[model samples]
Target: MTFLKPVLKSILLTLLIAFTASLNAQTHSKNGMVVSSDKSSSAVGAAILKKGGNAIDAAIATAFSLAVTHPSAGNIGGGGFIVFMNSEGKTTTIDFREKAPLSATNDMYLDQEGKLIDGINHFSAKAIGVPGTVAGLFLAHEKYGKLPWKDLLQPAIDQAKNGFAFNWSLYNAANYFTKEGNTNPFMDSYFRNESGGVTQPDEIWKQTELAETLIRIRDKGRDGFYKGKTAKMIASFMKKNDGIITKKDLAKYEAIERQPIKGSYKGYDIYSMPPPSSGGVALVEMMNLMELADLKTMEFNSSEHLHLVAEAMRRAFADRAEHLGDPDFNLNIPLDKLTSKEFAKKRFQGIDMTRASVSDSTKYGRLYDGENTTHLSTMDKDGNAVSLTYTLEYSFGSQMGSKELGFIFNNEMGDFNPQPGITKSNGQIGTAPNLVEPEKRMLSSMTPTIVGKNGKPYLVIGSPGGRTIINTVFQTVLNVLEFEMPVNKAIEALKIHHQWLPDQIVYEKYLLSPDTKKSLEAKGHTLKERNNMGALMGITYDPEKKIFTGASDSSQPDSGAVGY
Candidate 1:
């Protein structure tokens, strides 16, 4: 009977793993849904939703789960924005973007010669900003979450403690960071197996230290990460590694609840994150401009249609660089003028329909941003929706992790303009509005957005593409609202980006036909082909039918829209 007990226990363990995997296999439901970059994380959110949790609760659980499963960008060491729309149609946003440590300087990344020091802004401990994720999640849960806080984080803690299957994406990222020539010493130790190699696919990978940290957070809420043991570990690591963060910095960190940037496009109300993230402002500005054009008259993806879109993008992004920054730091951002229809009308007047607008850095402020972050969108049957986007800056973030904490630190400080006034053609921008300041949040392009029609959420969407984030959200919204495509089809549609600098149209490889490409070139547009742009997570609701539809960007592997 004792021998049989061992075999039964083994069978039960195998069944549990199979059941977890099954959660990833399901994709549709009539009640609630969660779309994200990783399968396990999405499953966690859907499970929360099934348990009668609201969209915010699902989002909190999903995010923490991603910190365990999707290590590349999902993180406790990073920060981001969240736009939430309640069942009654009230809208608000949480700005948890990382802040520069008190010890940081405007020219910290510059050499004595006043030139930007190569790689230091991105590769060293100096790149880390004081993380705000834990604070942000705590604030959201305290204010809106229906479930117990510990319950929301339990799945992530379980995954970290009991282990989950290692997949190809995790393997590839580990391989890249743990390779011999890699500069980050911390990556190798954390991501490699005891045998000193990348963990193989299907292997059960665990993070004991991260599990302990999660337990602290589960027990103590915000203080778990922002004070006490976790805070001490972070401060000590920074002190030993030349990083600028300290216990005081972590203690003072607070996630702010701010009014979302509001605008209307063809009667649909749009809500998104405000400054510290240029995403919302730029997105609304572009939408306002696009609203003026009769886009429905043009054939989809036709050169004329794309040309019109590109012009609006160029104008809005030019303003984004010139006017946007941390709101607390730059008090005169003129939010009213930027999002007003009158301003969009004025900006639209300058567009020459026949030609592509030249990206003039001399005229605009300056522009540069990175390309690795993650986004998740959740919607509950009760009419609540959450659009959240977060990151660790560069992929795997500075590629640095704490041995004691078992989490990566963000290189978000690099988002600050490193030099005071050096705007370079190679995508380096040193603009006044974004210059580093003590405790100031760095500028970001993470656009988490929600669209409302007739007092209910019509679309919940966002993406993780650095500078391309605003455009991705813009296009996805347009696809549904203007062109009237379904949510899944909207996400599947080809995307394009033109960030007012570089003066080029970055298009998905198959987006433009030869003739369309030639026409664009003849209009003086420099076309650069990229394999893909932002990985979007989106959900839309149909009021008349009382139905919910969701989709994850096709380009992201293992990403899905899990619903039940």
Candidate 2:
């Protein structure tokens, strides 16, 4: 009897753990709406929807909250891109990418020895670019938002003021910050207590300074951050840190509204961010090339289909590296040449049915030149939809925190090619087309996308990853349109990426079958295995039922959609 009792107790404990894990993995739902991300941020977004705000309003609120709650990823100190499709069938791209400081020269990072010092170039204030997140969000709200600016900013302000309970995920991310051996003195102060250690779950974390800053922004509008006290604090901090940002940089910064890059795939109109961001153009080119194949019939993740997608990514990336850059600075990009049917066919011709092509051998046609800055998508009851993505570059930007502002600055200048000889005709040095230039926006991989079927919005989606942005969004779109998988499953499925520089195709371990790898190896494709890939957020609208279904990536600890 005693032995039997012990066995029963063990079984009960195992069952309990399994059940709790399952519950954690599933999403918490609301009316007909869904918000997804790491914990508190998701909840904040859902609360906004419940408050009568539309998708854009909810997304804006969520963005600000994330800037506080998920400080590791979101911030007002960086820049990103937004792609939106309003109810009227119109689409636009808002470019708010960070610009280089005017004092920035092409070879600013080069030392007398001409060697690029890893930490010096990437971790200093000199590496910080002019932030555009505030301008981007403001532009979005002015155009498509239904809620008042103050109303949208209120949630985050409150959250920052009234401290929130830290969770295990936040604890883990903070731990990573320390483990990276590069913790900025400023972050160390906020993320730690008086003991100078990471805070654990259930601990109270309050961002009083940030709350006050948000309050000021709400009261003074975008001007609050750009030209007022907030700007002064940021500029002062830059000066102290030997950074080049000035009052003029902040006052002159503007988020430009541009047309979304458009393409068609299997009868659906696809819209994504345009140049300065290489994502939209690269994505469109990949889809155009893919249109030549009958992918709908191919088995999902089958070696053949997977290999083909990999090849397509490689070719597109080859072109991306060679010609894509900021349009304002580079010669007008031959958009026609890149997306033309003829160009697609010619690029596809390089792919051998039986094997993968070598990276250097994949050729793109004549090109003249060119290109997270996070994504949030919103749809109003009036049929207006917005897709916005914002970021601070790597986690916490340059990790240079402002004590007064209680925010981190972005290290986007590292994104520029620091090689000495890369220069532009305007005497701009280190300006590898995509390189840093004063007031010149840095290039990005953010690809916020909207797909419309039969002239109506169907899907609003995007992702976060330094260079994996395009491939993640591309694969998810195809999973729905070509593979016909439900949104949730498509997001959960394994992903593969090939960027051409590493000269290897990286795949999630779960996605690649031994047979598939062996077959690809036989075809001369270099294969690399990775555990996790990227995080994706997307919503698909069912025009027939007029219902919106949202799905967020499971790879992240917190991310799911809520529908009302």
Candidate 3:
């Protein structure tokens, strides 16, 4: 039993790393940068940049490579957001986040008694959404890419076919799938070695089937996967497995070009995904509050700083729960006001610096609401920068896949509030701005963001940590833009998060000092310590010196950062 406990702990830690801040940081770089949760993926993106591809080209290439190398979070069977800023200082956001299948309904995850059904909303066939990565990549390339789309995808295709070194991230993900007593046909094919043992480090692991799939996508473009053979294969699997997805659902999925939600903190312009992605709005709200504080006078990790950040997180998250959802679904969200300086000041005044405001006291009549996600930040020599975050929604997503497609499907439907009107055990009456609806995208926490200073990209930041993604990106931005820390130190510093509900401040273990915790407790805040937080990969540019520094975070030591 004692041994089992350690095994279980290791298993959970592996899954946690698989999902969040649990990735390794294998750092390196010089001029332009590419930093991601996977070494091979980063390398591929860097190589693309060296080959004369622009930032969008590198980003698209990196995304596809991650689909093969870091399948746990980097995915094609899923969807995500991209924030791109070109040399002209023009920044655009591509919102390719997954949408609900037309066959889906608000109550699909509820039973006869209107109770929330767990498995059905999570790893079951009903959990899959109409995917958007293929469409998203194509559209981003059409608008901003330089290298041929086939050229961008070929690296990933060759890597999958010719094989790459089996790394620890993939090793742990494989363990997580197997140890958890779950089995997917795709997992069986993807994770296995010829001798039936776990694939070892330094050993070459190949995905011949996945390579073939990528080849098809390269040869045919968007129609390759969504409208033809791949579509038929997915529809057939759904039909046999009690899933509701149809060829029509796949055919209708389109990646949208959305205006970046813009904000400023201390002279740096922030550009992030809007609406369906609540990240930018929450970030703006928090930064607005931080802007009001005299954080410069306070020491890093001081109780005052923690209190300010926690309060901001609490308020912004509260606002997110109240007002955020798919903009196309909930049409009345105060998109402009909620992100305005005046609104942030109003929200800031409600916070009492001396005491913790629990969820029950958080108000919402005026407001709004808004990750198994992998993130990477790339910058080309031409000054074009990209901050992209993509995901399968959970570790290995629905733990389901189309046998013929060679990719896992996202269990994104779990993101929506099941039984939207149901009350939680907590006293706060929960809001359901993110409930499922036919063709409506589920709300996500992914905060793929870019910061511009003096009309040029100053920082590129994002992460994968489910509920923690927003705060992770938020704190990192503050570290650089406000505290004036270098890119490496900004990502390596201790981090904390408080997401309105739960009412407990989640601090990184051994990172938050005892004195700080004591002060927070005295301030009426409950505390919970966690071993990890999120894999925050970022790069910062010093325009004056023409220098760029990239960091993959200390949480995941093998995270690779490459530049040429």
Please tell me which predicted candidate would have the highest TM-score against the true structure: 1
Candidate 1 stretches with Cα past 4 Å from truth are 1-27, 194-196, 365-368
Computed on alpha carbons, the lDDT of every model, listed in order, comes to 0.89, 0.75, 0.84
Relative to the unseen true structure, what is the C-alpha lDDT of residue 158 in candidate 3, on a scale of 0 to 100? 94
In terms of lDDT, model 3 sits at 0.84
Taking the tens digit of each residue's C-alpha lDDT, what string does model 3 give over 50-168?
Answer: 99999899999999999988888778889999999998799999989888888788889878988777688887889888888989999999999998889999999999899899987
For candidate 3, the C-alpha RMSD (Å) to the true structure equals 5.0
In order of appearance, the predictions have TM-scores of 0.94, 0.90, 0.92
Tens digit of per-residue lDDT, candidate 1, span 432-542? 999999999999999999999998998999999889999988999989888898777777677899988778899987546779889989999999999889888989887
Superposed model 3: Cα runs more than 4 Å off: 1-31, 179-186, 195-197, 365-371, 423-432
Report residue 254 deviation for candidate 3 (angstroms).
0.4
Model 2 scores worst on lDDT over the 10 consecutive residues at 362-371
